[model samples]
Target: MLATTHPQSGMVATSRIHRVVTGNGGAAPSRGDTVELTVSHLTKRYGETLALSDASVTFKPGIHTILGENGSGKSTMLKILSGVVSPSEGTIALNGRAISPRTPHDMHELGLSTVFQEVLIAPHRTVVENIFLGYDGPLRRRIEKSARAPLAQALLAEISRFPIPLSAPAGELPLASQQLIVLARALVRLPSILLLDEATAALDYADRDLVFDAIENYAAAGNIVIFISHRLEEVRRLSDRVTVLRSGHIVETLERDGITAERLLKLMAPEAAIHA
Candidate 1:
């Protein structure tokens, strides 16, 4: 995947920093982390089906949307990125480092967090507890409940449009708010890389608005977010660059200004689209 570079992005080398590498290279360079992620020639197969075929892409400090139809390998790519599934062929690098994560835990350690379409959250736990389930994994807690409560509240304030009671059971929340909670939990630790795989699919109009707000706030913190969705309108509004995939291969990546619904719809479903 070709790495994208921006003036606000690149390695921040200071007194303690010895090496730095910028995102000017086609293949992400190793050293300073101008590029947050790099994927090359990724391929995956399930039985006789080719889930991904020679696909590649990169991640920078902004929002990027992966546009595709059902079974277009968007989820497969996300699994590979989150380390839930292994690519048959490819290499993914982060922060000038290459990794092959065999499980989600590996990604967590890399400061990469994801909220899948299917919720992995515990239903019976309170909202705050659910949000901080793995807080100990990322950082040591000095005062478990006190430290976590305030942090979760602050994160919810930033990401959630409505104030949900922290002590409420997770199962009692509506599905839309639950989805937001999942996303909020992912962002609570301030991960450098975040992935949302069809997260807003189950949301209503109002819920989608809430989700978009969190996504924008997440990106504003100098982090990279991978938004995999079929909604063209949302993708257009949220993505900095749009990456289109068909039959498991990358078709093109259009800059936000260089795109429109007609153009994107055509690229997304060329034969079925009726152009003006």
Candidate 2:
């Protein structure tokens, strides 16, 4: 009970705390040591509808916001990231290895995960079933249903900061809650990279904030997060870096310090930088 007791130690013991310091006081994420995914010169085109064009980006361990208006090809970029669709031209690297995902199944095998704008959970199934919907006789090699619910709960707990009712039907939940469900499902794979395509469009301000907060955490854990959002204000607030896409081409990539709502809008404006 002395003043200098170790149990209630003063600044001396507290000062010995183990703080995780980056290479330079965490000023920037250490890309060389911590990058999870790399995308270079990616282009996607479907029968003359150019979705992306020569887009090159490196996703470090941080949340990156893709800023674009509708039809700006942001969704195309997300789809490419998740391997939901093939790119006309580009290279993607996961875990420092190059991979060009030609199919959704291929990307999943490579640890590239995503949640699209639309929710696709089975309406009649329970949350547990929804989580394990794909893990059946084919994928899991006879994984029993009895063992799936607890496993789903564990997976949910890994990424979710709050308690989710495992018994509820995912389709019955509100839009925001269902969005969370999709996010949780993607995280179940414990992927090295994550892609979000307008996942927060239906969310209110508070719910959007909650999801973005989770995104920050996910990125901090050394996972790459590629997010596309049409909400310019949210783009500025949530993204560590912003990539502006206009008509399938990356107009610019701005750091958090360099981007603003006015600047972003001006860059996206029809009168700002357009070639007819």
Candidate 3:
């Protein structure tokens, strides 16, 4: 297990930082615990509109941020990755093996879970019920019925300082609390690859910090987090690598050290940068 010190907090981040060295050079993945997710020539279209075009990037076990303005194909990339939508062209590979995820559940089974920007929850369901909703399948539940509440409570406590009642109807809770429930749902899956599409948008500062901490710790444990957010500060804080997209096309992929507001702006919108 490799221990890392957070640049901002100066806290020793520990657990296990799993890394894999690629051609671009990063760290080597530990014995038997390596993951490399590659998207090759990924393209998506909605009738005449190209939402994503020839976008390709690789993600290892760390925080990878996707940045773009509205309609810049960030969500489309995530949608394809999360199996919410299929790519019109190209392929995705995990550990050098091709994978075509037909559904979100399929991606979940492949150790990828997504918390989309939309807070998806059953309004009438209890908080615990909402957290553990998808786990209860026709065949079996991921956690036993008795075990679900305790796990949900523990996860909630870990993610939020504000206490949410286990039995309270999720619809009655504030939007922040509801968003937390959706996050807990993804976290409970313990996915090797977690796709967060503006997952923290509804969170308050404190809760967002807590969630960021959780994300760091999760990545430290040899898992990959593919994050998409419009928040530049959040991107600067959490991104190990960043891919900038514009008008459905990938502009550039930057290493952590290369990330800068000016450079990112220039890459994302050259004409605007020129005018500015």
How badly does each model clash, as a count of residue pairs? Answer: 1, 0, 1
- Sorted on lDDT, best first, the list reads 3, 1, 2
Error of 3 at 167 (Å): 0.5
Model 2, span 167-272: residue lDDT tens? 8888887776677777766655545567888887877776677667767655655556788877777787778788888888888888889878887887677675
**Can you tell me which runs of candidate 1 are displaced by over 4 Å?**
1-35, 138-143, 274-276
Off by over 4 Å in 3: 1-32
The TM-score, computed over Cα atoms with residue i paired to residue i, of candidate 1 is 0.84
| Pairs that collide, model 2 | none
Cα lDDT computed for each candidate against the true fold = 0.73, 0.67, 0.81
Give the top-scoring candidate (TM-score): 3
Instruction: Check candidate 1 and list the clashing pairs.
Output: 21-32
Q: Which candidate gets the maximum lDDT versus the true structure?
A: 3
Cα misplacement distance, residue 161 of candidate 2 (Å): 9.4
In candidate 2, how many Å is residue 138 off? 5.1
Model 1 worst lDDT window (10 residues): 16-25
Can you rank all candidates by TM-score, best first? 3, 1, 2
Given candidate 1, what's the lDDT at residue 77?
91
**TM-score, structure 3 vs. true:** 0.87
RMSD of each: 7.4, 9.6, 6.9
